[model samples]
Target chain A: MELRINGLKKYYRTGKEKEVKAVDGVSLEIGKGELVSVNGPSGCGKTTLLLISGGLMNPDHGEVFLGEKNLYRISPDVRDRERVTKVGFVFQQFYLVPYINILENVLIPTIGLNSYSASVEQRARDLIDHFNLSDRIDHKPGELSTGERQRVALARALINRPSVLFADEPTGNLDDYNAEVVLKYISEFAADGGAVLLVTHDKRISRQAHRSVRMKDGRFVGDDTNPVK
Target chain B: MSLINKPGKRISIWMIIKNELVYKKFGFITGVLSLVIATSGFVGAMILLRGDTLATEQLFMEKERELRAEMLQLEDDYRIIMRNMGYNVLILNETQSISELEKEGYASTYLDYEDVWKIAESGMTTLNHLLPVLQEKIYWPEKGMEILLSGIRGQVPVYSKPAHLTDDDQYRSPIMERVPEGKADLGSEVAVPLNLRPGDIFTIRGEEFEVNRVYSRRGTRDDLSVWIPLDKAQSILNRPGKINGILALECVCSTEELGQVAREVKEVLPHAQVFEFSSLIAARADVRQRAAKLHEEILQAEMAHQMELRREKERLASVLIILLITGASVWIFVLILNNVRERKHEIGILRAIGFSRLKVLQIFLGKSALMGVVAGIIGCMTGALAGVLWSGTGLSFSGQGSLVTPPVIITGLILAPLLALTAGLLPSVLAANQDPADIIGER
Candidate 1:
């Protein structure tokens, strides 16, 4: 699937008198196997752009399309349905439910919505194993290392096998070694024909992207195609 | 964070509840306990608030007042009946007027008292469910001695009293005020000397009468004295209701109450001789005073008890209300709300991964409903058990004798879950309304 944005504009009220354009007429597209990165300083609206593209927020104007389907034109709930089956989010903070074990955390989205059989469990086990955290699969997030926690978050994000992966500053809290492992995994995901839209302030991350969009104050400043890629 | 790998999951309500129990044991247990307490309170209140079942003291006062009113009516009716029969009458204040009455040749006497015995014709039934042993106790007082009781015990010679006094006096001392309707005083006394007591019953010529008391043991003409009810004796002796002798009291107005009784008696016997026994009238007044005081005490006691019961009932009701409203519902709302706030980021991730708002609502509401259901069931069982265990006094549930009935059960079960579901409402909606974008962006 392709995540396509056209003139997407989302405004925010910073104060009673001030309205800030968080995503001001921004547009972009990330096709399957595309590893696109949005880079900016603080307040540049990269996160806002990522959110609107992922169907997590509504744009004041313009539209977001997943392939031929205009997500913003669809009903909010329908868009949510589209998101549940089609998109995944990896946050910098690794937002895992604290009480649930890693395996159950991975299963949280399926709760009361889907049935988990041996294959489902096996898929989750494979993800944990691929992340080199099989021994910690049943452990809670509190008991895991920072890298392990982020990996669990990654595995959880991919548990639905979303066609589009949204990673917002995913490696912002990770060390260089852990960040390298995360980048390699995200690169591998794009190699496997899954689209990845990564938002980061880190130049190292932007350099690794096959394509990069640089933003200043919610508008695109430049687009770069990495020479190596 | 996803429902991707397989066909849509069919998660049952039970599975959700099981997960809730596993995840939130303390909240679930507390919710249930509060519901149980509330339900039990309701069960108890139902019985306590029922009509037709008065507290024992209240019942006693009611019955005593009824019996007194009946006795007064019966006495008035009997005197009127006697006067209409063209019988000469003499009214006396004191019953012990043998000296004055004998001097006037109007003293009624009996010798060798003969007991008139009659068998029950057939099918004489009593309303008492505890009456199967009545016959054994009725005819042969010794066989059912424990149940043998005396309504009236008037001696024929030494202490003869008209027998109509028995019914109202059944539960009182036999010396209370009596009836004036009777047959002529028999000159011959047919005595039955046996080990029989005054309360004993005997039969003669298919007639039945309870022994009043052993007549004089002295070897005198009074030794044969025996007494029976005036109407029964008249019926047995083949005489109409008539009194051959009169005992009269010329009452002087010492109190307004005596003036009333004197006025009533004078209304029946216009020309009857009257004599005053001031001491006996005073004694009767004293007795009436004591009785009135006792009745007042009983009323006050019952009123006080009722107030206490009312207060207690209100307390239980208030507690139940609290448990239903603020206790179970509010506490659950707060707990689940805290969970939502604490899990804001987690909720955001779930939402981003495709969990719908409705799904989010379902999780929290489902947990609350489970809590309610469990609390309801446990409360119902324990409340019913409390009813059964305390049914000895009916104070546990429904102060009345009603058990934990069907309405109570239905209310307990339905109300608990409903209330719990209600408690979960805002929290669930708030949790479902969480904005994934805001939460994720904040992270």
Candidate 2:
């Protein structure tokens, strides 16, 4: 699978009179099984780029293509439908519903999906076991550590086994040890032929990606093809 | 997951119900209260009205019976008075030529005296003779009179002595034996027997007659007067053929039809003064008017009472309806608002999970509707129990012990919940349509 964003522009209104460009005429492409990181300082539109790429936001002037389908060409409803089955998202805040248990959290995406089956429990069990969360499957997010919670979120993001994964500051809230563990899972996901668009401020996690890009003031600043030595 | 998915996609009613139960229990309680209020008010009014209706019917029936009885008595009295008046006219005409000496002379002399006696008694006898015919003529039966006289010698009974002074010399008059003291005080021309002590006498037509008996009047007309035989009356009047008026008292027919019967009698006997029993009683008009006024007043009062009861019932029902609707709406609104606040995150999460804005709204609203339906059923049962308890006090006019037995109460119960559901809709929809992205982004 390949993902492409062309001539993406996003603007924000401040007060009633002021307008600021959050993303300005930026474009990029990622191939199948590639792990790419979009690195930027705070408020640099890294997360915005990821959100737009995942079809969560409408760009003022842009087009995003996943495989051969124009993501923005279809209606928002159709785009949401496609995104549910074809793309996965992980947020910096974990976005794990505090009330639900880990297994229930993982099973959220399959709730109303036509292809969902009773065997989803077994699939969820498998994912929980793989993430070393079997003992904590019944525990709520409040009961889980930061690493456990992030793992559960990641498990939920990959529950439908989407072809492309977008992670926005996935390690932004984790300690060093849990951050390393999270990066390892993301790398494993990329190696297994899933495309990843990762946004992060942490250089240590960005170094693990095959391609790294830097952004500043709503513009791409650098692209490093070489992995960090 | 597949079974759950199928139902979830189609809008899960059970999920909606569960969510409402979890969130809006207080609204449910208020909805039940509303049903109770409405049902109690409506049914209570009906019960009171029914009781008043029954009482009114009873009073009307009683008044009708009394009026009917009074009219019948009046007719009976009218017939009696008319017959008596006719007899008096005949006696007066027959006795006009009789002198006192001749009347006494005729009594002494041995003669049949039948023609004179017949003439003297003709008026009364004529009525007696015509009674059977009149009985058939009128709708009611006529009354007949019988009279008899006997003389006593000392304590032994004897015939009156003729002035011939033959074998019956010891015979005494019946009047002397029966007359008590004070017969002389009535005057000397009143014939007291020579062998007896003097007593009071009463004059009839300027001639005195001894009083024999003093008793209260026993007929429908309570009159006080001297009773004298036909011959004596003729002698006192000095017209040997004349007698006092013959009275015919009647005891049949209802008073209600008396006026019509009296009118009919007047048409038949125009010369006689014909009057019913009610006409003789001076207080009759006053009594009747008073009774009529009382009846009218009672009817008016009862009508006013019923109107008041109806107005009160309506007022109560109106108040109850207003309170029920207001209370239910307020309660439902508050409950839904609180529920929305509590479930804001759930709504946000569902929206994020690809549940459409419409779907989320349906879920919330459906839950509230389900709760309303359940509360309505409970309210009906509660109202029914309350009606039973209240009816035991005899306060209810419906005469029904059960709330559900009254159609109005049942209707109220049904409508109250429907109102609650309507009240809950707007808040639920607003809560559901709130933007999930904004909510999620808040944290």
Candidate 3:
């Protein structure tokens, strides 16, 4: 397994005496070359589960394992190193830094590792070209369309060549055609031998995945394998 | 083209800060402006304070010079007046009685002619302008008139004062003129009765003499005297190498007491007793001392007023500097804090992409430091210029290298950045410690 989780729980207190179970007793696993989508409605804990599994949030009670290493067991700095070197994240909001150009934004993850060089720059350029954003490579995010910004965000995520990719609502803000283009790129990442954990509310997104799980109120309600994969 | 390549370019924390500062131009500009105002205020205050001190010193020095010049001129004027009043001190033989000298108009006892020379070479500081006189009552056998035969050689220079070689002693001190050899100076009484004039040959005892000068009429015994060389008078009186009295003017330029003159003269010549015209000497000393005291009082009062003014200015400047620094620091803190709030999602995204917390901190802090460095340079220059202009017209201080000393400029350059870093510390930490999970999940 490339990514694994067992009984992850996260609770947020709403007031003095009331608590909301953002994610409770959620467990799942994803292997190499597999794209698994967690399907649920808004506030059903799909995003929370993805966040915990991505090594970003601490689970109140459970363990998240990436390859053979437990994500929460390591020191924060070590965890940060592991995340930068072995994992990638994409968001529905396409949070590209607005002041930097698209090429620089795609190369930002390389800066986190303090490892930018000629080869990294070449790779960033190649990725920008692959995303069909070569003409807009020097333009700021504010000058780009919604689809172009998402493409830039996607390029930034894949730049580090992480073993696993965690994406939250990756297509929630895209049009139908742009949504199809983004889903095609994600399926290609899985086919290229990368693990993908995608969380979304749309059932139609699950068809592009090798497997799908339904979650409600922070727990998995149903799990199934799609034959289309 | 393969996208211009932009060779040698690499992304780093500095690049992120630069881009962000450019993007948020309003916040960055305002932050820099506040720092400039504070830094300039501090530098200007320091320069003005130093310049004022230098100016006050220069003024004091000028005032002192003027007072000293005035005192010297007044002393010269007093010396002229005392000289015109005649030698205020007459040194006669120790055993000679004042009543006998007054009744006979000449001393019965006499001193050796070398006595005057002894006092002149003694380097006595209490007396100056020494003169030796030999006078006797004689009957002019040729004119058949009784006249006082006065012998005067001229004034002797005291060893303490610089030798005055010229006869132009009118402005300096009164000097008795020397009667030329083989010639006589005839008093008005003797000259009018004998109808003698300058250039006329006259006989004194058995010696033939030319009338070198005829004196104006005076109501004193000097009007009945015939002045000649000391050697001539000594020969006529048959009193060789003898003088009845030594005449001298008491020096009143020092703080020494009037009585000290007689004591000092006695120390030099124990055989001589000094008889000074105390009223004349006393008046000269009183006027000189009063003028000196007034000069000192004026200087002290001016200094006290200057010091009080400087203290008030310093207090005002200190208050202004404190206010400016506090206001600037608060503004910087608010600016960075607001910047952190506005970039909440951006920080979350950077963290999600695996940026370490330290790198995030560097971004915010580096921006603040850059602003400080730029403001420091510009503010120091403007402050120095303003100090010069203000001092030129206000403080009357014009000293070179007073405004932009190394210590003050260096302190200002270092202080502005330190202040900015201190103000930006809390906000930078907040930006660094933000959790990506909470921020990304909220969206």
Model 2 lDDT per residue over B342-383, tens place: 778767655555556666667667765665566656655655
**What's the true lDDT of residue B119 in model 1?**
8
TM-score of each: 0.62, 0.63, 0.90
C-alpha root-mean-square deviation, each candidate? 14.4, 12.5, 3.4
Per-residue alpha-carbon lDDT of candidate 3 for residues A86-150, written as tens digits (9 for 90 to 100): 99898999999998899899999988898788888889889899989999988999999888888
Against the true structure, what is model 1's DockQ?
A: 0.30
Off by over 4 Å in 3: B1-5, B92-109, B122-126, B135-149, B167-174, B182-226, B257-279, B393-401
Q: Against the true structure, whose lDDT is highest?
A: 3
Error of 2 at B241 (Å): 24
User: After superposing candidate 2, which stretches have Cα over 4 Å from the reference?
Assistant: A66-68, A114-116, A226-229, B1-293, B309-324, B338-345, B383-392, B395-400, B405-420
Residue A156 CA displacement from its true place in model 3, Å: 1.0
Distance from true location, Cα of A80 in model 3, Å: 1.9
Q: Model 2, residue B142: displacement in angstroms?
A: 30
Candidate 1 fnat reads 0.58
Compute the lDDT of residue B197 as modeled in candidate 1: 60
True contacts kept of each: 0.58, 0.03, 0.85
